[model samples]
Target: MKSVFRKILLLFITVCTLFVVLKWDLIRYGWQQARGQIAIMYNAEPLAHFLENPSYPDSLKAKIKLVEKVKTFANAELGFSSESQYEKMFDQKGKELMWVVTAALPYSLESYKWNFPVLGEVSYKGFFIEKEAIKLAQQLTKKGYDVRVRTASAWSTLGWLNDPLLSNVLNLSNGRLAELILHELTHDEIFIKDSIEFNENLASFFGQEFTKKFFKKQLERYASELYDYLLHLEDRHTLNKFVRNYLPRFDSLYQKIEGLSTIEKENQKFYLIEKFKQDLRNQKFKNPKYTDFIKSEIDVNNAFLLSYKRYSGHQELLERKLQTQFDGDIGKMLDFYQKNYDSL
Candidate 1:
């Protein structure tokens, strides 16, 4: 009996070790595959044609131009490293991950098509799986929005998956991308789990202010191109609009929820979740009646929803402190954030 038990224990240990070994390789391969595909699609002629084609809407073309500008600024100004540098940063083995770019053509003004790049799927959980963002892009395609999307396992999603998550960067402009890269890199510098609001708020505050300083420095060298640069600033305007519109309502709902009893709270939670759709409908953000999914998706009032709210709220205060205390020095701003280490 003792001999038999020892044999079983040895087998279990061996299997567990094997699983760990396999999972690491799987993650690495997925990252590499995603990276390679992005590089290839960006360089492909078909994509180039689609990007330049005049038939595409002028606004989208402008956004694409913005993307190019952002990438240039990100690579040139922000600390975005070369492919080799990325490999070194991640301790990669120099294997390139392929990213599948999906640029949807409009079937109509209300609808768009999805284009999946060749060789796009990556290994996840021991199986080859299509990326979730690609899936979302496809679904939106069916609903109609002139969606041009892409799929990559390795490219950063700017920590939107975590609480206090960064608002997603769905087909964002260059200015947006630069901010995202900074925010995510900051996470590597400091992270506190289950505090999504604090994490994201810190990142958002850090990234936005950091990028401004970064751009200011770049502007000194390229003084003639300031107008094109300010176009990116318009993105922050849009973000502020989004925050102002949503934050008040979210706070009101949170206060209401706080006053309710446990049973009442849960019941109210369900009711409010449903009512969020109506609120969105009333605001004309979208037609609530048009989707197969509604109640499950409308979570604007969730406690976790406003992880970044506190930080976003105190942003001006923090900025004021930085300016008053440090005379708007970028290095000092970095040091202050790093030292204070509070969520807001």
Candidate 2:
């Protein structure tokens, strides 16, 4: 029995050693992410603490109260999870928490996916260290992948850890703040494995729809807020329409250039991208919000375009289905997907 036990222990040690040797990069990346998550969890304080703290600013406290109301509304009215998420606050102290890196083929809309332990396959990866994200982007770019790196203010743990309301989120307008809270909560409600685009679109749809309902119920007092939110929605609609109309043109451009040299293809790709930006500049918007967004906010590469599609591609379809088939019942629409996602 002693000899058998010793052999098993030796085998286990050897296997672990081999895994570390072969997957050192993955281990390192996971360790960085774990450290970042652990830091946030450790620093988080319960909402009651901040609400009761005399030294805390009244303005921030009010935002905290608004968050509490939003969470309750999402749970009691919208049928999202009643988990302990957003019950705590994480003060970022004006520093970004994570940077997300997304990559795609330069000539096609296909995303460059990374396979992980539990997430299976994902199109984007997050880094706690910005430099590390930049390093990865450089490497992918060298390999001819179009890479986009952007800062993320909030994320969900899928109930694994109680997510905290980030301080930056409090700075958004009242309507946007509510939407952001509901959007993250939607992840807790349902997440389909390996289908990042579908999961994101579902969350976006519910988030926007729930926000509309919340403001509508309070419109007597929040009329101005609702108007502002509607304007924001209109701008979003305009951007979505632009992308929907132009993405096919991009696809056609790529298809026609299949026989071109790599350098030649890259030149043409960027030329077309500049033309797209010019067209965006020429269009009149309902608000000045997208002017800066078009000029400098985004890199407007294949990865960026696909990122928009990932979040909003199926929104109209989902909205139509909700109205026509589900009788405009968001709860029933959610139930159908929760039960039928695998088949989808």
Query: Which candidate number has the best lDDT?
Result: 2
Candidate 2 clashes between residue pairs 3 or more apart in a chain or in different chains = none
Best by TM-score: 2
Off by over 4 Å in 1: 1-172, 220-314, 339-344
lDDT of 1 by residue, 256-327 (tens): 677667677557655655665565444322223323233345433322233224336556666687789889
How far off is residue 27 in model 1, in Å? 12
**Whole-model lDDT values for every prediction:** 0.46, 0.86
Error of 1 at 172 (Å): 5.1
lDDT of 2: 0.86
lDDT of 1 at 52: 65
Q: Write candidate 2's Cα lDDT for 1-344 as tens digits.
A: 99999999999999999999999999999999989888888899999998999998898898898788878887788766745888888888888888999999999988999988877788899998999999999999999899999999889887677888888888888878888888888888778789899889999999898888888877897788789988888888888878877999899989989899989998998899888988887766777767667666457888989988889999889989999999998878878877876521
Q: Residue 141 CA error for candidate 1 (Å)?
A: 21
